[model samples]
Target: MSYTIPFPRTALLAALGVACLAAGGARADAVPAAQRPVGEVTMSVGPVTRTTAQGLPEMVRRGTPILPGDRLDTADGGHLHIRFIDGALVSIRPGSRMLVEDYKYDPQRVSASLVRFKLEYGVARAISGAAAEGARERFRLNTPLVAIGVRGTDFVVRAGELTTRAAVNQGAIVMAPFGADCTAQALGPCGSSSAKLLSADMGQLQVEFRPQLAQPEIKPLQGAVFATNSTPENGSTVVAARSVAAAPAPAAPALGRTDSERLATAALADGAVTAAISGQAAAPVPPPAVTPPPVVITPPPEPPPVVAVPEPTIPLPPPVLAWGRWAGVAAGDGDIALPRAEAADGRSVTVGNAQYNLYRASDGQTELARGLGSYQFALDKSAAQYSLAGSVSPATVEQGRLLLDFGNARFATDLRVANALTGAVGISGAGAIRGDGIFFDRSVAGQAIAGAAALDGKSAGYFFEKAVGAGTLSGITLWSRP
Candidate 1:
């Protein structure tokens, strides 16, 4: 005689889910060696698939490895949640296709990390991780018409061929159209008068970009606007006929276990995997208690005398260009999008870096007057990069001082690049100042540092690119007279 045991419907479905995930892991060996795993699918529902870098397509389930250059596609009602190696999270909505353009993360040198994603079509939500926080300047998400840059952000994007929509869940983003001023080749955010700056403080407002326009328009985010469609082909439309999947059922505790723990037990019979999805670590078990012996207290040490040192004060000569970093903005976001240069008190009417209207401000009218003092580097407002063959990490800049002699019509600057990988690399350059306030490195192997002073004489800035072995070290600085 043979006996058959009955299984619950929910348990049966969970078992199948577990088996599908296991199969996905087993196929990992087929991926090429050069294409390493950048993330993993922690949760997947319905018809989800991934197209590999080599153009291989397969069904994706929970536990599937997400490789660089992989394209993820979801059918109607399909959903996917991924956790990247650097702790970033991405949620792909139904009827969506997202491509992981590039992802490079090094735990030891997170500043060198680069993360890029392209939302081919549909909607996706992204949460910044260590890679983004460590090197916000290197993170980018591209759409058909616009490129989005972030400074430690959590955001959502809906992409279409003609239009792109972006909303910030946390932090802020700089959205710019791909044109002569902003290009795909550049990393980090681009700033232009037409660029749109969106932050969570703006409430439920979303930035909408169109291929035909240079500036992005703002719109309210209605609940129905982002809903998934019952019909897969109509998913991208604003109106929704029906929901593809039902909302998850409320949890009912079986024991004293949490909802996640209960689901982990039912799904894979393991809680470790659930921890990754929830972004929570398991609580450590306390050690066994033991009786303590008598303790003896020690006497406190004597305190040392304190002395206050006065800070040095320097007098300002005259106003030329008032050099100051944009208040309340991170250095990674680059320059603020100023509509026009502001002229004040006979100073240079505009202030910006190489990427801005500053280059155009040299219209033969503004002149650099002879000044005695030097402009000091604002370390807090400056940023540098140390680029090796396979990496570009942040470098500490110190001893930054630019000496200017308008009487001699010359300028010189020296700063040290303290890089963990290459140690400290000294950089020193000098060049003749031109009548138009423009200057170029005259030192041999010139152009080590090329920059200009504001015609108003209030501010100055330069761009540096120096070769170090097989790699190059580069950075930009904003200076003010001291």
Candidate 2:
């Protein structure tokens, strides 16, 4: 028997059917590939793996296409290099995790391209591509505490559990606190209206974040050790604004020896000889002793002996080695950043490689070193190396310090304790090196000495002997000239 449903029941059933249809329609409209692939893995070494947006995980291999929302994880010794369609390159180091949050590039319509990256942990190096050059302000990298805006430059970034660090190799980058829309043109909420711009000079710009601090701190990349206080204290929320001023031009060179000698000869001929001869020659023409003006020879009060003031001494420049590219590495337990006390269980370590183009200006006083290289680390049984490049202009050899720049990185050490040999060199001091997505602070007595020289004129050596708690956590580095 047919029965008519109540009006309310009929209406509810109709409503449910409509809702189902709407949900089905929404599902059909969702296109997974619409976002497009931003880049592909060009190089993968050791144990690199990735997790796709579909929640599927697999080992990463060369040529693997990477899309937004994909997460990459590198194990000890694992290294991954990605080249985006827009020509950007990113190198991921070992024991690190990163995510390609979003990336869109349209060669024809460059203005609409966008790039976004999330560094969950570990280190990575990035070289700006078309997106940075075309859509200069649309690229962003997010870390635990900061968001970095790209400005068509190269840079390195490291994200740790308690801290985040960034170094600019070529070009420049702007950083702001998390959740802030920091851009190359705008500082957003994290920066004051008068925030200073950070740019790359002969040294790399460094920005660091601490949990207890409200804003990040900026400084030149000086490789020195930083002491952490374990005591819990109230956190401060004040952010300091800073900018790097342009360096002054080098001073003019001192007068050449040839020029000084010529001037001296002229002076002697013009006055010294003439005066001496006149005094020695008798009053020949007694010149009409005219006035013989009385014995006015009362000899005015004897004038005090003219006291001559000594001229200030100008320091001579230190003897410098040849100006060209020198490549090497510093490896040892001290290369590890962890405190020795905390590293009870042995932690894996790897080597680092560096190249420097040491140059001296005609002034004999001005010197500089432009460097580029990579650091490999093996932590938790995973190994990987990240790329880095920078320069240290005017690398002066002064009484107090020796500063070295590697594009977006820098190193500063005490010159007093540094020794240079034909094929080997050693430096020890309370110094630090920042850049290449890493921050290292050497202890007061920490020393880095390399002695072994290869037949190719390269040096393979170790660094760090007095690291606080990094038990045997050292680094090995190879320096090459090519």
Question: Pick by lDDT: which candidate is best?
Answer: 1
- 346-374 per-residue lDDT for model 2 (tens digits): 22111111221112122221112234433
Q: What clash count does candidate 2 reach?
A: 46
- Estimate every model's Cα lDDT from 0 to 1: 0.68, 0.49
Off by over 4 Å in 1: 1-33, 230-482
Candidate 1 lDDT over residue span 1-482, tens digit each: 11111222233334323222232475756855446687778788999999998999999987888888899999998988887878787888898999998898878999999999988898888878899999988999988778899988878887876567777767999998776567776778887545788998888777877532325766576444444542232123345578689889999968686778657434432455677678888555466699898898989987887878789889875433333332334335443222233423333323232222223244345566555344444433456767787676777677687876566778888888877777898888887876656665624341246667766555676666667776767666667665
Q: Whole-model lDDT, candidate 2?
A: 0.49
For TM-score, the strongest prediction is 1
Task: Identify the runs in model 2 with alpha carbons over 4 angstroms from their true place.
Answer: 1-35, 179-196, 202-204, 223-482
TM-score of 1: 0.43
